[model samples]
Target: MPNLPDPLPWPEAVAPDTTAFARQAILNLNRTIFGFELFDRSLAQGTHTSASDAALLFNVLSHAECEVLMQRKIIFINCTHDTLASGHLELVPPERVVLELPPLDAPQRDDVETHLMALTDIRRRGFRLAFDQSVLTEPHLSWRPLASFIKIDISHASESELSAWVQMARQNPKARLIAEKVETEAQFAMAQDLGFTLFQGYWFAKPILLSGKTVRPAQAAIIQLINLVRQQASTAQIEDVLKRDPTLSFNLLRFINSAGFGLKHEITSFRHAVMMLGLKKLFRWAALLLTTSQGAGTSPAVANLAVVRGRLMELLAADSLTPEECDNAFVVGVFSMLDTLLGMPLAQAIEAIALPDTVVDALLHKQGLLAPYLELTVACENADDAMFAKASATLKLSSQQVNWAHLQALSWTETLVD
Candidate 1:
């Protein structure tokens, strides 16, 4: 590694677990984002241990936000051999994932065969495979045919060594070359000259850490309310649940009166919110609340951000979408932070409730009419001019309109906080 300057220290108040994930973009020759390699940011090597691999997969698949992430672009995940055989592997859509496996350490011939057997099963399951330079070594040669991507660490490889590996991988026809660890212009130029089509490392962009504290909800009250709402129970019974938990009641009223709901007046009572939203939307609101409920001492910043996203997307779509689609857009925006809010495996939270297919598509699949609005809201929040321009263009909205809605949403969130 070239001697890069040291990065600023992590904030003292930020817990290690808040360093939940780090995703480094993988770029194609044209320098577009092809996929991301996700890492456990807390890990020293940024690689997953067996347990963490399963946990990461669980988090990725279950979180509504992560679903949107996977739907748009492919992701490369580092895996231990044990993770290859994990049932969690079966849960992911094979086409959207590429499992990067390390080669055996000082493998015996039989050890190669054992690993190959696992790889074959996984490959048959439809996941593509990526390997380090060790795949070019003779012992691992039998495993070569299954490779869809071969990554060469350009930082370590001599020009002649890189040339040899590139030539060998080219012979396979199916295996594309990735120049990993390309931290400088010279390394990138060298790899490009050698015909590497995919590149990773600090040259294009460093890994971006996504952090969030897990939300732990007091579920009994919320679950009962959801059940009651699901059964189309009378408003009295539903109100009973809210009355039992003052915090839930407070949160419900706060959310209902928020600008995104478009209420003509404040909904100070639980029964009023139910009557206004009707059963369908009321249920979604409650289900969403299940995840948003945070324990004491936990910051409300994430939930507040979620509401801002919800309202921003709603305002952006108000001119373009129907009432129902606008509401779905709000759900997509709020639930976009589902993984961080729920704190548990996403599967657990999502499986317990039902969402409209359109909301599901926008939240989980990043597809449907509302998805672009959600994307625009995020772009606006991040102040990403390029993405903001692209998403606004896709939706055919002017920048002035989006900026106005964004400022309005932030201002509205302040009211909720106060």
Candidate 2:
């Protein structure tokens, strides 16, 4: 057996249940999530150790039910200067991931050189690299040529200082500069003016509400399908509604044929899909369709939040609610954010669908058998320790159960993307 070093101290961040992982989007200039930077929300409050980062990657990739991440977006992971030499990251395919190595605190070429062999090995194996703008200075400069991306904090420098930093970064023409903390349109533009095409921040996720806004016609068609599925309408009746929009029908076929369904053969038509999947399956698919139908303008972060909420709520209710009630709990979580997703108020957005009284009540008023589950799920997302303690006790659940369920929910949501 190999000897190991003493355990590294955990960062001061509030401890999360061992099962939970938090993911945030890394967006590009066009306001789309180019990648997800995942970390231990449980460990987020405190400074992170490279050990934690390695563990996060292992947890995210080990789950087989979901692809480790979105197909099109790369996943950026934090790496310690030391972890680079630990050989812990060899299990992950470098093409799909980037190691965000922090700049050397000071130029100790001996210290930096110790890991250079491993660093160059990972880069040779296809792993890209990201670092702060500081890497362009000092002994770290020796490490700069290996960088594929450099992130400059918009808030970290004064306007004049920022211009200098951007100017300095130009020396590394091979590296793409990323502007982080770009929260508003003006800053985003400033970053672009300075020549940054990649960005990270929440500017795009803010709700774009407008007065007198109602559901779009496309959204209306989706709502109608939800109602039909709820009523257990015949296939022909459901097909009539589906035929109204080729897009809705096309999305349905795509989902049915998705890896989630694991169909051995392709489903070519609506009727064939219906017969193969049955009405119960169709109803579940329709519910998912309605929840996810708001696209293009919708931020993936918002949609991802809704899915996590729905999955968490359903998981929390599993032990206490009937099978039918569990389904409603899931629906409540998924639709809880529909008002935000649709850009219409909750009352009006939900009014278009024929959801069960319990699901509708929980989403609208937060009162029903399922409402407690919704509140608990929100508490988990926010990491409200007091609320989590109270809700878990009131529901007669243990920390272990909640942790297990929360982790499972996150894993399940990851699978929903593809």
The per-model lDDT (C-alpha) reads 0.69, 0.72
Q: List the candidate 1 regions with Cα displacement exceeding 4 Å.
A: 1-19, 42-48, 107-109, 206-418
Best by lDDT: 2
Would you list the clashing residue pairs of candidate 1?
none
Candidate 2 local lDDT, 145-209, one digit each (tens):
78899988896567788889888888888899998877666787888888898887655543344
* Number of the top TM-score candidate: 2
Give TM per candidate.
0.46, 0.69
Off by over 4 Å in 2: 1-19, 29-33, 41-47, 66-73, 85-87, 90-96, 102-127, 133-146, 155-164, 182-194, 203-214, 228-240, 249-283, 300-305, 356-418
The per-prediction CA RMSD against the true structure, in angstroms, equals 20.1, 8.2
Q: Clashing residue pairs, candidate 2?
A: 13-46
- Backbone clash count for every predicted candidate, in the order shown: 0, 1
Q: Model 2: what TM-score?
A: 0.69
Q: For candidate 2, give the lDDT of residue 11.
A: 25
- Full-model lDDT, candidate 1: 0.69
